[model samples]
Target: MTIGATYLGDDRCDFSLWGPTLDQVTLEILTPEPQSHPLGQDDWGYWRTSLDNIPPGTRYQYRLNGDRLRPDPMSRFQPEGVHGPSAVVNQGDFSWQDEAWRGIPLEESIIYELHIGTFTAAGTFEAAISRLADLKALGITTIEIMPVAQFPGDRNWGYDGAYPFAVQNSYGGPDGLRSLVNAAHQAGLAVILDVVYNHFGPEGNYSRDFGPYFTDNYQTPWGGAINFDDAYSHGVRQFVIENALYWLREYHFDGLRLDAIHAIYDGGAKHILAELSDRLTQFNQTATYPRYLIAESDLNDVRIIRPRPDHGLGMDAQWSDDFHHSLHTLLTGEQQGYYEDFGSCQQLATAWRESFVYRWTYSPHRKRFHGSDTRDRPPSQFVICSQNHDQVGNRMLGERLSQLVSFDGLKLAAAATLLNPGIPLLFMGEEYGEDSPFLYFIDHQDADLVEAVRQGRKREFEAFHASGTPPDAASLETLKTSTLKWHKRDSGHHQILLNFYQYLIQRRNTNPAITTGDRQQIQTQYNNESRWFSVHQSQANHSIWAIFNFGETLIQSPPAPNQTWTKTLDSSESIWQGFGPTAPQTLKGSESIKIPPLTVVLYENS
Candidate 1:
């Protein structure tokens, strides 16, 4: 079959797709009654046509060489199912108001990661936008939205998206997304979409029929790897690159969080990531704001965020899993799974000092020497979070850190994250300590696929059997339980946690030492036996010290009697609503201070 198209002044008004192996090629146009265009090429295998009148909203599907009709691989919009007619969408037609919105710098970003389906009661992009002002008021500079690409069902976490270009119809489709992003920009919050390029969903994947989109050479835990380095990979790469640009160019998304770069598996001269980053950079040249890319990688490789000029993939940042693990292990003391490798205060100290554990050290869990020092890199290149979707949702029943740690411990965790050097991120409902579990739930037409998901979850948690079996994936209760309790943000224990988070974020934003660049400028001292640690953040002219006590009993180690320091914040004081700032205390060169049980204290040098 021969592919043909005619260009009129840089715009293609007509295009023809041929499948010689089939019976006929019928052009089913949605406008002016669906019309059939007959095959005009040599042999019925060839189809050709050109029309200048067909404009946007002209939905069409080709009756392949004759019998089967399939949507175009390059379909801009699939309002119907993947098998239905493809609608013409003019991306340039949408009016955008973000001309003055320069993208938020990676360093200054305090991201709030959210899923639309659970973020609000309505579960639509427009509905999610209603909370933009609230999020901005909470000091969130960037909103890292979970994937919005079309998946198989009305409700999903969005990682199983098969229609890479189409926004989920249930979430108000393309127009809803455009409005959401525009509204977010208007509210002074940058939108960063989470994109999955690793694998497609189990159902409704038509890429295999149209071309070789998957490769058997490598496999991800979810499914087969995308064809990134194989023959015909150019088209596949173009498809993904175009999707990335589409979100930024058409929807005005400020950035993207690339889901699972370790599963990308590219063995080519120029990796797909390098090409994608280059294209994004080119687009940024003309765009009003710079676009950014963040990768989710388990490899702990700094190359993921390193620029292409330095022989790296050129992502703007990456989620620091080590930091999360260190914090989680310290707070919960649940040493199951990968957490078995981390628990001591030393682990947290290492994460604070070097930004990664197992950096050049042999990891018993992976059975290899993993990670490298990120000391030379800017702290902004790593996004740190005490609780994220994976950290919460992947649990046996999707329990958050709040479930295991005391209210004081929760405040301490907030202090550690907000005061750290990296970009701080918080999972949805985490700021208020919502008790709902973010379980894995999906609505697939294929019952076998549903059952497979259930079985997979059971096997994944075999090691953590004590955590209890995961909520049944097939139950509607699972999805319902994941929804955020918005009312909790203002009452009871939730209100206390919310206030603590706000105060920590406010302090982080206002203090130069807390938000500084160099990781080397930070110093950490911890006693492994005592289960206590002190983090001192110092710049050329100013310094702030934070002390955390994780033990069960209160301990007094005499205050420093020579050097004077003022208490800026503490988690133990009732007058401060558990957020304390004590009067100035004098300290000697080798003096120590009293630390309460499960409390954190911050001191600023006078």
Candidate 2:
């Protein structure tokens, strides 16, 4: 049963709400007479009533306990923003065109992470649709968007969204999203939506007015924890479950990337995450398009993606910060904050072998041993990225790797991430080395909230001794500055970087040994002081070897088992806009190939 207004056809409509603490609930219709209908509550804390022939496009609000008209908790559309009344839209009007669309599995995903607001100048779903063809051509099988849930004002990172079911009105709302998804499927691109389930945004969240949606017993980074497994929390649990189903079944999202499961603290007998996983698995059983769940967690517990039958959460995959941290530290040599735990070829090699460098190892940042070895899991179960919203946006300047590392270093980062056995995730604008930063921004109307956000942001940088004030979150300039310069795709060094990224993806997909997530097929060796490494891969008697140098000077490569080899890809070649290669054009055996600084060379043995 739908939690909001459901039209039963022929001028008959049914409205339902879940409110246990309220003495009275009035449905204030803004059309067909501007009247109110009193709802009867059930023993299960549900308030609902049937109406006949209510006008279409009617705006409504729920007046609870005789005061404060609140928007629907399950509002499909909120045209007037978060504080406004929810509008009823017909869900059956749209004609979907992708009847043959079957979603790409997580193993085959070459995910591109993008924020709609910064992805295009217009920042609307309709505008985003124009770029799908280009992404498909760029070798992206899936596009994982940062959240689109309706937040306050016009601009946000979408994590501040207060309404989970409502699409951001600034980004073209419900129809906009549905149309985008339909167009994406037609282009053979799977859409994975990033969803926030841990905590609600700070402002204009009215779920507490209707019932207990937050818990006092636990605290999260965003204040109170969600009321999962608490007293009268079953209804709250249903609300979250239905909201997830709404996206997958109604909007046809191929998958969901659950935001920060580490913060989704629930100490119940059955954790909410495990319960949600069971429900999603059930939904996937009958769904036309294959549905998947990927979790973003820091708790290095392999249980997140482990099969449900193994008594673990049955998520398809998780974002691997350990992989990112190891790669980023090695590339840039910046050992600040969490990066303090990683900075050496050995750490990167550990991530390569076991998927977590800190797996039960002593962590300098956390001040304790963290993570567990995940060797039993396939490499595809981890999604690794060189840069993402968190790695860039949370910085004081929101600087990308392009700004932090050398030109050759950029290509090296691309090769390491894309060529890894794990799934590779590329942040928007990263393919072309877009110079603009992805800053954390918001458009809240509350002055007090804005000031508090500014002060809190400044304090966060003190731990790392980061200087300079972050751009004001409330300023429109902050949002405008974060927008991608799409023209970079057509010119100069930027165009070369784009081609380099495309080449990396092509090589990864074409190599059978690389595509198969088998750990035994890969061998990694490195020298921490020399800042050089090699990954030798083999499958079905075929073999390919990749050597990477991260130092600023020339280095000697490890000899190939077979002396004769042909160059497949080289980041140091002048064609990809890197410094000239230091190695010979062809090798006949046991030769020490001269590897240029910050370069990657892939050779196929004959």
Candidate 3:
């Protein structure tokens, strides 16, 4: 059923809500003098009303059984706050100018994930729109926006969303988000929104009170698992499906990144993910441009992205934690937590050849036999990243890869990320090496909940034995500290790093072997003692090679392939602030060159 206030015509609106178990719900309009109207309830317990007095831009709420008014679950504009009345927005009022904007394809996507609250100082959609040209020129094809749905307060990471349909009031509400999407399309960039479907935030969530939106049978880390297989699940399923459609249809988002699909517990005859993908496919066939859906899952299950005909959930792609953890541990030599399972250079080599390193193998961190073999899957079906929000924000210190590694180490991470066989994703400020940490922050009102949050945040890092006490997550300063420092991008080593990243991305697009995203086309070799690896890619009579040295002291170079080799990019060049430029050398199968201590080099061989 179509919920929320839908503007019908001049000075008229149709308000509808679904409540199968609630006894009463009255429509309260708070404009042009307050008035209450009785909504007629249907046989299925849906309360609705058509009023000629209510017009667009009107503020209204539903009073439940003489209790306090509650904001609409599917509100389009929460101008005040989640606890306040919702606004009536006219869908057809705004002007759109993206007629010529065809969306970015998933194969060619270089996504830049950014939080609207911390991306810029202004922290508004309109302000963010001003910088799309910069990102478009930086070789990013897609911009993944963190959640913008209205939460409880002005400061949040956006995962604590309460209203599924409403835009956050602090982020300039619905019109602001539309403006950002339209601007992004005009700049030749596709916008992907990160959406949470497992559970709503602890504060201001009224779905449980209205109906069976949650199930007690399964518990999630955040809250009760959303009811997908339990009684009265049809409505619950419809609510989620409609919510996904609402973002794509109304907000004009090109894609959605499903957050924490691992926590979504559904055992029904038809999986909720498969149903969502089918609906997206139906829309993509008729839409102007293709829309994609990505999942952040830890299951390592091939069924999530496999074809529907193969009896698998038909998602477009999923994030690979193995790739990130593999790169992290190999680069830093840190063997704590999940990193305990992945310190070998051989594991990094395996992650590049296969999407997962521990497929059907015993995982020391998981303490169980985990994952299915994903050799048959396409490489583009996995999204790989060296640094992202979770890897950085969830840290006790919220330190980025920049803080933990040397300058040469940072360049190696960037080269491996771009040259690897998968879709690449960069966190905000990652392009320019923004050093500001991406800390976990929230602004909750309840003292008890806030204390619980602080305790939980510290407890998760106890195994790491963090050196310092973590900042209180409830502090608004924590949010402010995470904001990007735009000034750091144009000077010193940061500028050189930025230029090097742009060059790698350019090669990724122009090179045929790198562009193909086929794991079978890549041949990898590594040595754990030497701390070095080589990636050789060949396709359609074209071949290129890249070697990364993770060792600190200069060592004898590994044997180069017997061929006519031409230098493409040498990270040891003085231009990149390395020791010195590598002179052209002849490799007669047994020759060795004294290369820089820690660096990377790319070459083309004929």
Candidate 4:
């Protein structure tokens, strides 16, 4: 229904609002000289009006019941902050050069997740375009941008989006985002935008005044759940469903990463997640390039990715944190929070072989049997990463893997993620091992809301038994320090790590076994006492072996018996700042090789 101001060209525009609960709606044009127009309501509770002499870029707001003035629920652009007037934007005005881009397949994707504000000091979408070439050179095929939905203030993790449709004004608004997507397409990189549909930010959200946008029947960690099944939920459902399509259609985003689907409570016959996926499926039938919907769910249930016809949500893929948790606990030896459920060579091996360490097993952290088996699910249905925003930034100090693990351990983490069958995602600045903390930051005008957030961040880390208070989320210094240290990529150990990453990504892309994403052709073996693990992926006559030493001592491991092998990459070599390469370049049948402490070695059959 195009809920916001739709520019009709030639100085004419139409304004529409779904305010079923309100008696009257007045459209007040505040820019290009003030004007007022009373809108007419239909049987569906939709207030709409068409006006002449109304041009594009005009600022306007709706006066509900001739009293409370509010921005459009589906505002296309908020030139000012969330509390400011909404601006009219003609989406068709910009000429696009990515008509031929069909997007990369999900199986072929090597995702690089970045926060626009922290990826560069400029913190604008247009400013981020300058670095697309660097990412492409690193063999990254996809860039998953953190949410750009209009949140309060300029600095945030972007999960606190108040306006579902409007682009954040601090990040150069809609035009800036469009330019970045266009540039990314030109660079042969698919763009995936991280979106939050579970809850809106606490500040500057005005949807409640217009209609039943939230439900009290269920509670999320944030507050009330979104009204996906309550009374008068049709409009609310349409509002969010269309919002997902709007990004793919207007901004040219190749996909959307749905944040925290676990909190999106819906008790309807057709779940909201399934309904959204269905709409995307229909859109893709006629789309020039297929768009994807990836979910972030903690349920660890295979139904999230199963086909819709089989009574499932039908998501293209989901973030599998079990893999990350398994790897993190092993490397850092921290068994707090969800980490209590992991920290064993068997779990890591299970994640490598089955993509889920739990899979209906008992979880000591949850004190219940958690997760279901996904043995039949394809490996591409999961997205795995060693470090991401939640894993790094949620800490008291926001320490990155580079800060917690040794240099050799960092290399091993990179090898495990990049060489796995699941789609690998690298957090921004991890390639060169940027040590700057990606602390959570926000800017809200409400003093009470700000205090609540500050207190909440501290309480959240209590499970980790962290000592110091978290850095102030409202501090400009926190935001400034989170920005990637780009110049460090060419210096000392950072450059060495960066080179190692480049080589691994290149091999993953070209290697038949890893690139196939076929779980049936892979095998994993691990020894808990020795703290060594091996993953072997083979296709036809080609094979690759990735062996790891999680212990702090040297271990002897055989690559495979009765076959010759050549060392492709050894993290213990001097080139990687290791002690030196002690293992021979070539090996024969039944030969046990020495693997240095916390090192990763890759081998290809001769």
- Model 2 Cα lDDT, one tens digit per residue, 297-337: 99998988888889888888988899999999998889888
* TM-score of each model, paired residue for residue: 0.92, 0.98, 0.97, 0.98
RMSD of every prediction: 3.7, 1.5, 1.7, 1.2
Clash counts for all predictions? 12, 2, 0, 0
Question: What shift in Å separates residue 422 of candidate 3 from its native position after superposition?
Answer: 0.3
Candidate 1 weakest lDDT stretch, 10 residues: 1-10
TM-score of 3: 0.97
CA lDDT of each prediction against the hidden true structure: 0.79, 0.87, 0.86, 0.90
Clash pairs of candidate 3? none
Query: Please, what are the lDDT tens digits per residue for candidate 4 over residues 1-606?
Result: 777788888888888898888998999999998998898898887899888887788999999998999988789888888988998888888889999999999988999999999899999988899999999999999999999999988888998899999999988988899999999999999999999989988888999999999999989888878999999888889989989999999999999999999999899999999999999999999999999999999999999999999899999999999999999998999988888898888889899888898889999899999999998798888999999999998888899999999988899899989988899999999999999998989888889988998888878777667788889889999999899999999899999999999999988877777754567778788899989998888877777877899999888885464567888899988888988876788877667788888988888872
Query: Candidate 3, which ten residues in sequence have the lowest lDDT sum?
Result: 583-592
lDDT of 1: 0.79
Q: How accurate locally is residue 154 in candidate 4, as Cα lDDT from 0 to 100?
A: 88
Task: Name the candidate that leads on lDDT.
Answer: 4
Q: Give the Å error, residue 84, model 1.
A: 3.6
Query: Between which residue pairs do clashes occur in model 4?
Result: none
A best-first ranking of the candidates according to their TM-score comes to 4, 2, 3, 1
